[model samples]
Target: MVTVDHLVKDYGTLRAVDGVSFTINKGDILGFLGPNGAGKSTTMKMITGFLTPTSGTVTVDGLDVSKNPIEVKRQIGYLPESSAAYPEMTVVEFLTYVAEARGIRDPEELNSRLADVIVNCHLDSVKYRAIENLSKGYRQRVGVAQAIIHDPKVLILDEPTDGLDPNQKHEVRKLIQAMSKDKAIVLSTHILEEVEAICNRVIIIDQGKVLVDETPAEFKARIPGASIDEVFRDLTKGSALA
Candidate 1:
């Protein structure tokens, strides 16, 4: 459902993403792993049409992201590392605005989508509360809710469960898993166990390039009896240097 071909993103002389390539099919939840400044977010931004690639291309469901930004965006939902929203707006108000922005014009459709996201994200208790007053975990849930408000075909989530507590994290993981059957998901996270639990495939990148692309089992098998963290450190240790 999503194809990234030799994607590169350069900020002046500094290259943030270099020649990254990967494909995500429906039902695949790919764990995108990398350390800070590893270009994971840059690549995702390009794929979502938020940032134009310096070179190469990203295609979503057969539509080129650069050339068909609007259409491609319509097919994908994105959550940045930090979930930003109008702090002044209530949860329902914010979501109602997003639903309309996503082209749900009819009142019935808007209300239906709003209700679905509120329930799915477990925001019923805070539906009428202003976003500024919510806790970090609740804010993250609100972010996820907005992303999935239109029931997008592709989900690009950066640190999806960043601030959630253990129970909240489990709930979000379950929600992602439930949504995976019908969508191509690219989940960027630092939580290895989360990846092991929900991601079937994994891609580890560093210094703007992909280092490992394999199934979770294949990746774990690389270093027998070693945990995912140990194997990951072994693979990208060089980039850890200053």
Candidate 2:
């Protein structure tokens, strides 16, 4: 449901994303892997219409993100790495604002959506608390909740389970797996185990370019008996060796 063709993002002389291309179909959860500042988020921002690409294109369901940003945005939900939110607003209040901003005006729909995210993100216990008062895990959950509040067909999550206990991480993985049956999901994560567990396909990038794109098995097979970390290191070993 999403296609990125030759996407490039440049800031002056520095190129952050270069010729990145991929397609995500329904039921496909693509594991976007990269090291720090590897342009994963930059590519995602372009896909979500948050940042205009220096060149190339991101299209969602036949709508060009650059040409029809608003419409394309309606088809995608994005959770950036930081999960920034209005610190002073309570969870309910912040979500209310998000719903309104998303143009979800029907009161019934708003309430239902709110309930769905609260449950999905396991935020029922802290739904009434102010965002600033939340712990990092709760804040991450809140970020997730807001992203899915609209239930867009495409989910782009960066570090979706960044701050949480192991149990919480597993719960989030289950949530993602459940959601993947109907949506096209792209999640950038450092946790290889999470990717192996939840993602159907994997795409690894480095130095602003895609280095490997394969299924988990396909990738693992390249380095027989190696863990994902080992194979990953092997694939991107040049920079480290340099």
Candidate 3:
């Protein structure tokens, strides 16, 4: 389980995140929704221990993130918003580097893992292509493949389906759903229907605060016939966040 208690982050005079708290249990897929610059990425970063909370604590399965960063990171896999990668390296080279960095030292084991990821992510055709030479959709797939090469217990994905076609999005969603049975997954997305389609629970935040946290059915049930976007606007239109 991932437990966040009273989390906060500040940038000079601006508060990027303020007193946010939530728990994501195993086998849960939590969809984090917020407007642009509303601190969705910041919260995810803090949860994955990429950024420290200014005040509160984040604990993953009982290990405090700040106190045991390495251990916490060992159990989690993160895909950042930028999908950062070694642009100079081919997909094969890049994934190999990632698998090694993840401590898969046995050559045979590494190759076996790579083979599975290539097929799982449908990267067989582009596996030999340079990351910089791949299309945006292919690059996104490469990013995802690297994040899951080690198959950590927790998954943090920021815009996991960004820049994908309809088919690509469906493929990624299925991968997530299949993985959700074992891992605690947190995904931040601007796509409302995507959340409704896959996420069992949803969180809507604005102005660095959580305005809604409930099941997708309950969230929509708040106003009969209203879409997720309508509920989001109603809850988040109160103030400009960020």
Candidate 4:
């Protein structure tokens, strides 16, 4: 559902993303792992059409992100790193705005979509509360609800569980796993446990390039009997595995 070929993103002289290439198929949950300044977010932004690539191509469902940006965006549901919402708006109101922006016209469908997301994201308790009054976890759920309001074909999440407690994280992960059945979900995060819990495929990137792309088992096998963290360090730091 998503293809990125020879993608490069340069800010004048610095290349934040260099020669990155990958394909995410339908029903796949890809974990994009990278350390700070590893260009993970840069590549995501390019794929989402939020930022143009310096070189190469990205396509969502065969629509070139750069050539058919609007169509590409229409196929994608993006949850950015930060939750950007009108603090004063109630959860329902904010999601209604998102539905309108996504060109959802049917009031019945909109209401149904809103209800589905609110329930899926466990927002029923505060569905009528002001967004600013919700906790950080709830706010993040609100962000995700807005992103998926249109029921896009692909979901791109950047640090989806950044601030949640263990239980909340598990709930969010469950929601993502449920969503992956019919949508291609690509997420960038530093948490290895998150990958282990929800990802079927893992791509480890560093220094603006893809270092390894493999299934969770193969990734762990790189450092036999070692944890995911150990494998991550070995691959990213150019160290010899034990």
Scored by TM-score, the top model is 1
> Which stretch of 10 consecutive residues in model 3 shows the poorest summed lDDT?
233-242
Q: Tell me the RMSD of model 2 versus the true structure.
A: 1.7
Candidate that would win on lDDT: 1
User: TM-scores of all models?
Assistant: 0.98, 0.96, 0.97, 0.96
**Residue-by-residue lDDT tens digits, candidate 3, 1-242:** 99999999999889999899999998999999988878899999999899988889999989999999999988999999898999989999999999998899799999999998999999999988889999999999998998899989999999889999999999999999999999999989878899999999998878788888899999999888999888777777755532
Error of 4 at 207 (Å): 0.7
**Per-model lDDT:** 0.94, 0.91, 0.91, 0.91
**lDDT over C-alpha atoms for residue 70 of model 2:** 91
Off-target runs (Cα >4 Å) in candidate 4 are 238-242
What is candidate 4's local distance difference test score?
Answer: 0.91
Model 2 lDDT tens row, 20-69: 99899999999999777788889999999999999999999999999999
Q: After superposition, how far is residue 231 of candidate 1 from its true place, in Å?
A: 0.5
> Judged by lDDT against the true structure, how good is candidate 3?
0.91
Question: How good is model 3 by TM-score?
Answer: 0.97
Clash counts for all predictions? 0, 0, 0, 0
lDDT of 4 by residue, 87-148 (tens): 99999999999999999979899889999999988899999999999999999999889889
True-vs-predicted CA distance for residue 228, candidate 1, Å = 0.6
What is the per-residue lDDT of model 1 for residues 1-242, given as tens digits with 9 covering 90 to 100?
99999999999999999899999999999999988889999999999999999999999999999999999989999999998899999999999999999999999999999998899899999999999999999999999999999999999999999999999999999999999999999999989888899999999989999989999999999999999988998888866621
Model 4's TM-score against the true structure:
0.96
